[model samples]
Target: MSIPKTMKALVAYSATEYKYEPDYPTPQCGPDDIIIKTEGCGVCAGDLKCQHGAAMFWGDETQPSWVEPPFIPGHEFVGIIAEIGENVTGYKIGERVAADQIVPCGECRFCKDGHYWMCQPHQIFGFFSGLNGGMAEYVRLPKKAVIHKVPLEMPLNDGLLIEPYACSKHCVDRAKIEVEDIVVISGAGTLGLGMVTYAKLRSPKKLIVLDMMDERLEKAKEFGADLVWNPSKVNVTEEIMKLTDGYGCDVYIEATGHPSSVVQGMQMIRKLGRFVEFSVFGEPTTLDWSIIGDRKELDVLGSHLSPYCYPFVIENIANKTLKTNGIVSKSFAIEDWESAFDAATGKYRDFKVAIKF
Candidate 1:
């Protein structure tokens, strides 16, 4: 009953226009909604894409129409329950939690099929469709978004990584990667590195990471990549072929969404190999159709978001299997959000960054 009328948040709708203001109002709590006092939030690479006018808008193309501007945008967040709606009875006050940004309509066809990630009217929060993101003092979520009880074994601040972890887990699941399968990742940023870490758990016979940047390539090696390739310095295809004895990787996970990388990803695979496009592409890129569809008989795939990856991330963390806290190299406050974005996606940086609330 005592929620504040307005609070400060980072609001953006155009590339040249992002502002920090105190005008976001806590929404009227629906029966199933809970308010969260955000503790930490990440600035995903997709967040940077929105700023540079690459994110697609269903009806608006001229403007960088990400989420409705004037709305906060850090959906990758973790927090404590600040207020619970009358009908929300499961969560305790101050209970620690993280949530899914991709909120689904439970009655949709995909939801009926138990694939909520592909729901037709998929309402992603902190985008343009729903409440202010966690870049503020508090945020509200429907019970559907809440995934409670990350193990207390690891620092709760790292729980902001659950969303990104979900992405890698989905990729692993889709590829159906087998033990001893040779895997190659075509980017070593957070998502790519997450893939390296998680894919290794399946006991792959070989794992390699490819990147144009040496910093990322080195980071991949630190994460247990059997080999790391810098395309700037070596012929990636030749190296991969040599590693697999002219066979090819059983799986190629494309995490950068770069066109050139896609080309390499396809070429890096053996006949009948699977390539999961895990990155967010800025725009359409040309692919060699003859090679992609004809010769190689490749099984190219595109995974959007995770289905049930939250708990696994927590488990990985609790069990000391995955490293999220150490992967983050910088932190920025809500007021210094632009720098945080640049820091995370900036060319010289090789780590993830977050806006701590």
Candidate 2:
């Protein structure tokens, strides 16, 4: 394949400003690097929140902005290898692949401790200038970037799901669910649906899902959720208590990113239960600290990006065990990125929206 000198991409100029260039210079790969011609790139909620001026992304009075301008803005992408550097041994040109979103500084203390996901000077691809993301026709995978070959049999849209699915696996791992445990997943969105798919593999006592969308809740039932709830139709907490016989759920995974869901999770989780928070909230959420400490004695776990779970995710996708049916609601061309972004931002209530090259 002939590599082009320039390609189309979306570059960030500010929290709310993005430049859609039709012919931006393509990224160059180093000796140990590789390049992929994007097949699909899913627009995540974080991208939308960052663009809408979320303080955590834009930085406010007391914090520094995490996302700098002039960087591409799509992390959940899958592509075919267009170029491979001289020393890149495992990959070949024309292979399908997905790159881990975060590129850690190998010398950092966390990386040295085998927790690369916690590296202090994290340079996430697509957000930082040094590691540009896949919201383009082509993306460069640097030496430090973790790359995994995606099986060709998987649909491109399904393959683009690796990143978020991997994160869901991490969240499930954090919960440490037991076969006898009652698990409740809040939010039947993509991440929550991903959780339901994998959580069922553990064979928990009961798998309950909550969402306001009846359609998503129905999908959850099909994905192996033992029970599904619509907060709009019933008092979720009250119904949960009835289902659990007033004991409350043993494991509560919060993926709604809604402030009320946080409070609801705190109230519905049993004493000494595990509460795994996996959502990237659009704004600060305030809740009573007493429930976490003195009141319930619950174990609160915060889940970040997918770490050490990529291989498992890859295997699931290859095996068709991750439930990709109807997951990708829409795919748009690079020129229609604005519509794609809007659809992905929940303007259309789609499961996932991606840009296809």
Candidate 3:
């Protein structure tokens, strides 16, 4: 395989500015690094939110910006190894692979403590200029990066979905679901559906999904959700309470970026129930804090980026234990990124959207 001197890439210059550069310099593999020839990369909800200057990415009066511009914006990617450094072991050229979204600085306290996902610098691919993402013809993996070999037989869309599924796995793990507990997962988007699949593996007494879109709700059922609800057509709080014999659900996982879903999870979870908050909200959510401590005494947990979950996601995706069909509903060439972005942002009724390189 021949590596290109220049490649097509989506470059983010600012919060609202992104350009598709047809001649961006292809990353070079250092003695301790490897280069991947990108096959496909998924468009994440955070990408869409960052594009519109969401406070979380752009920062606000109370918080600092998490994103550094002049970088490529995609983290869910899969590719073939085009070049391998002399020092890199256990990987060879032409192998299919995917890497964790975050590249931790090994010297950080968090990294030293085995919590590299929360490294102080927190440089996630696609958001840091030094760590370009896979929205290009090739991507470079630093020696410290966590990389996993993807099965060549895995479908392209399933390969691209590895990152999101890893995230969903972590979120579900945070819930600590029991076999006899009733589980309620909010939102039926890509992440939520992935949660449904993994949560079902626990064989909860009942797994319920909530979403405004009937299309998404239908897919939830196909992914092993026992019951699906459209919040628009039904009172989800009352329905969940009724299903739980007025006790409320034992576990509630919030995957919807909407504020209402946060409120709904709080209102429908029983006392001492575990609540896992996983979504990257576009705006601040105002809720009654008293409900968490005074009324329910719920166990509130936060789920962040995928940590030590890539290998599991890759193996399960290859084995078909994790369902991937109908999740990646649309794809576009890198040249048509604007249309892809629109489709990913709900302009079309899509479960997930990807940019093919």
Candidate 4:
């Protein structure tokens, strides 16, 4: 496929406004960079939070803006390599690939210590670090970008989910579910369902899923959740305690990014249990400190983005180990990004929404 001189892309000018630029310049590959022809880009919750004018994304008085606008806004994406840089090795043009959402500065203290995920100067794709995102017809992966070769035969639609699934795998690993443990995952959204999938692989005695939406709970059940609960309809804390013989669940994972879920996890997790917090909440959540340190003595773990799990995510999706059918509810062309954004943030709870190039 021939590369174009200019391409259409959604250029976010501010937290609330985005302009569709028909003449957006297609990226040129640097000596160590690679250019990918965008085929699919998932609208992440981070994108939605920024679009909704979250102060955490846009700056307030105390904090600087995390997601500066005036750049393309997509990170969870997959595509065919259109060009490879001269100094770039280990990859070739025409290969399918997914770049890690983050591009670490590599000179930071964390990078030097091999914890690149905590790199001081973090430049995430689509979040305004001068590197444009995959919402366009083409996107450039910088030299510092971590790239994973995706199997060409993997379902094109599911390809966009590679990032989230990897993140889920990492979160479940943090939970460290024991064979006879009772695990509860709060929220049955994409990542929550992913936890259900990966946690089931551990052969935990019971895997319970809690979501406010009945539809999402049903999907969790289909994803091999031993039990699904609609927290809106039941006193989920009491229900979990009863199911676990008043000991509470052995592990609780909070994935809804809701403040209430944090409190719920604290209440439902047993003494000495593991609590994994994986969501990026829109607001701050206050919880009792004693619950974590004194009363329960729970082992609290925080899960950030996918680290060192991309290969497993790729192989699982390619091998059909992860279910993909009905996951991406719909796909829209670049020209129809308005509809795509609408679907992503709409009342309809889609497992995933993609902008197809």
Candidate 5:
């Protein structure tokens, strides 16, 4: 297969500034790098949030900007290894592969301590200029990249979900659900549904999912959610309390970027319950801190990008243990990225949307 010198890509110049380039430079593999010919890349909520100038990505009064523009915008991607550097080993051309979203600096304190996902510089693909992402014809995986071989039998769309599913698995791991525990997962989008699948495997007493969309709620049931609720239709907190005999759920995982889900989780979780937050919010969420420390004494944990879970996710997805049906609701050719982004941003209320390269 011949590699093109240039390819189409969606480039980000700044917050709210993006353009599609038909002849962007194609990535070239370095001495210890691998170049992937993109198969598909999922559109993440974070990407949409960043496009709209989310404070988390564009920087606010409290924190510096995380995204350095003039880069492509995609992290959930899978592809074929089109090129491998001379020094690269254990990989062959034409094999399917996926890399972790974050490219850790390795020398940072967090990376040295084995928490590479929290590398101090925090350069995530698709966001940092130096680390271009898969929203292009080819993506370069540097030497430090944590790479995994995706099984050849997995569908491209399913492979595209590996990144988000890995993050969801990490969130479920943080919940530390017990067999008798009643777990509640907020939001029925891609990450939320993935949580439902993994949480079910934990054999929780009851796994509940909350979302406003009826279609998503229905899909959550198929993904092994014991109960699906629409906060708009019923009193979710009251209902949860009734189900738990006024004690509230044992674990709450928040996957909705909306602030209301955070408040709802706090109100419906048991006093010492595990609360795992794993969403990228477009705006600041205001909440009382007393409930966490003084009142409930909850164990609040924040889940970042997937850490050391990609292989598990890949294996499960390939074996059919992790249900991925209907999660990838739509796919668009790279030329039609605007429509894809629109569908992902709720124009079609899609569960997940992808850009097929």
Candidate 6:
């Protein structure tokens, strides 16, 4: 097969914030690199946060790769290899795979110690200093970071959800949510809903989801949440405590990043219980230390992009343990990115947003 001289893509230009246009040239790859013709890409909330210059997108503009004005926005996508670079091993043209959006340099002390996820100089596919993402038609994958033999195909239009499921796997593992333990997930948005679905894998004593939107609340119950607690109507913390026999919850997963929810999260944790701050809050929020004072012993933890959760999520999806057919409400073509972005902002209980090419 002959390598095409140019391919179509979406590019971001400098000036204002990153904006998408109809077509940009597909990137070329060198040794140890591969290019994938995108099949689908998931619109991440972080992308929206990055666009408006939130804390989510860090690094200096002077250092370069600082959104670079006109860069593509997408870290989550699945596709087949379109081109392979010289010396790239273990991957064949036309193979189905998911490339690691972020690859930590192996030389880092943290990486050499088996904590590769924390590699000091991390290489990310979609966002960050260098390299392109999947929001466009083609993505370049470094040789060492390509994930193969993973299930990236779904009946035509559904494959875009694989990445979100990968995130769920990590949350479930880090949350340490035990079966028969009362778990309260304080957001029914995409990430919250994914966490809720993952929380149900174990037959917990009770699973409650808190969100302002009744539509999302309903979707939460549909996705296996034992109950829906709307802070708008009921006292969320008190209701959760009441459900746990008034002692409080064994686990609290805050996915909203909303300050009010964060404050409520500090209050919802039981004495000696675990509180996982998993939300991608766009702005800063204040939490009172007194919430964890005296009586309550809390394990406050944070989970960034799930690094060790790919295979598990893939297996579960293969075994029918994870259901994509349920929470996936809509998919938009990358051309309609404006609507796609709008849909990501807690609109109508969409557990996940998929973009098809």
TM-scores, each model vs. reference: 0.92, 0.97, 0.97, 0.97, 0.97, 0.90
Clashes of each: 1, 1, 0, 0, 0, 8
Model 1, 37-64: lDDT tens digits are 7788888876677666564732255654
Q: All models: lDDT?
A: 0.77, 0.89, 0.92, 0.88, 0.91, 0.72
Report the C-alpha lDDT of model 3 over 1-357, residue by residue, as the tens digit.
Answer: 899899999999998789999999999889999999999999998888888887878898989988887898899999999999999999988999999998999999999999999999888889888899988999999998899999999999899889999999999999988999999999999999999998999899999999999999998999999999999999999998888889999999999888999998999999999999998876689999999999999999999999999998899988999998889999999999999999998768898999997
lDDT tens digits by residue: candidate 6, 23-69:
46667787878888887787788776775566335445444344443
User: Model 1, which residues run further than 4 Å from truth?
Assistant: 1-3, 13-16, 58-66
Better of 3 and 5 by lDDT: 3
Looking at model 2, which ten-residue stretch has the lowest summed lDDT?
49-58
- Residue runs of model 5 more than 4 Å from their true location after superposition: 60-63
Q: Regarding lDDT, does 4 or 5 come out ahead?
A: 5
lDDT of 3: 0.92
Candidate 6's C-alpha runs over 4 A off are 1-3, 21-23, 55-70, 156-158
Residue 316 Cα positional deviation in candidate 4, in Å, after optimal superposition: 0.6
TM-score of 3: 0.97
lDDT of 2 at 198: 95
Query: What TM-score does candidate 2 get on C-alpha atoms?
Result: 0.97
Where does the lowest 10-residue lDDT sum fall in candidate 4?
A: 342-351
Q: Candidate 2: lDDT over CA atoms?
A: 0.89
Model 4: residue 351 alpha-carbon error in angstroms: 1.5
- The number of the candidate with the highest lDDT is 3
Off by over 4 Å in 3: none
Ranking by lDDT: 3, 5, 2, 4, 1, 6
